[model samples]
Target: MHSNVVGGSDRIGEIIEVRGADGTPPYRVRYPDGHESLMFPGPDCVIEQGSATAAAGRR
Candidate 1:
């Protein structure tokens, strides 16, 4: 996800849980830095299927 904060770089993380209905928004993500957050992605965010598996492989 792209950070809205000025000077913040893009964030990469794996979706650990889904809080939305029928696999919608409000995802629980775990970042490479070992921090997790519940995210309601904005317009800057890109959703990719199977990206979570790829992210896990990188860890």
Candidate 2:
């Protein structure tokens, strides 16, 4: 996810839960650091599908 603050570090995570319907806010994501957060992504945030190779590497 993109940081709301200028020059802040951005993060990438796996979406573990969605609280509402499609295109809804307040998603639960588990980061690589093993931490999870409920987030409402802002304009700077983006979501991309993970590739098969990437997924395999995680396992």
Candidate 3:
């Protein structure tokens, strides 16, 4: 997820659990720093599909 703060970098996290019906919003995510939170994504968030490797920028 993109940081709301200016000059802040984006965050990377794994979707450990899904709270939304039919895989919608409100995901349970675990970050690399070992923190987890329930997230309802905003417009800055983007969901990418493909290989396990990560990449940035919009589609």
Specify the highest-lDDT model's number.
Answer: 1
Compose the digit string of candidate 1's lDDT tens values, residues 2-23: 8899999998887889999999
lDDT by residue (1-59, candidate 2, tens digit) is: 77877889988888777897885868898899999999888877898877979877876
What is the RMSD of candidate 2?
2.5
Q: Residue 48 of model 1: what lDDT?
A: 76
Q: What TM-score goes with each of the models?
A: 0.73, 0.67, 0.73
Quote the lDDT for 36 in model 1: 96
Model 2 score (lDDT): 0.83
Off by over 4 Å in 3: 50-59
lDDT: the better of candidates 2 and 3? 2
lDDT of 1: 0.87
Give lDDT: candidate 1, residue 59: 62
The deviation in Å at residue 38 for candidate 2 is 0.2
What is candidate 3's CA lDDT for residue 26?
Answer: 91
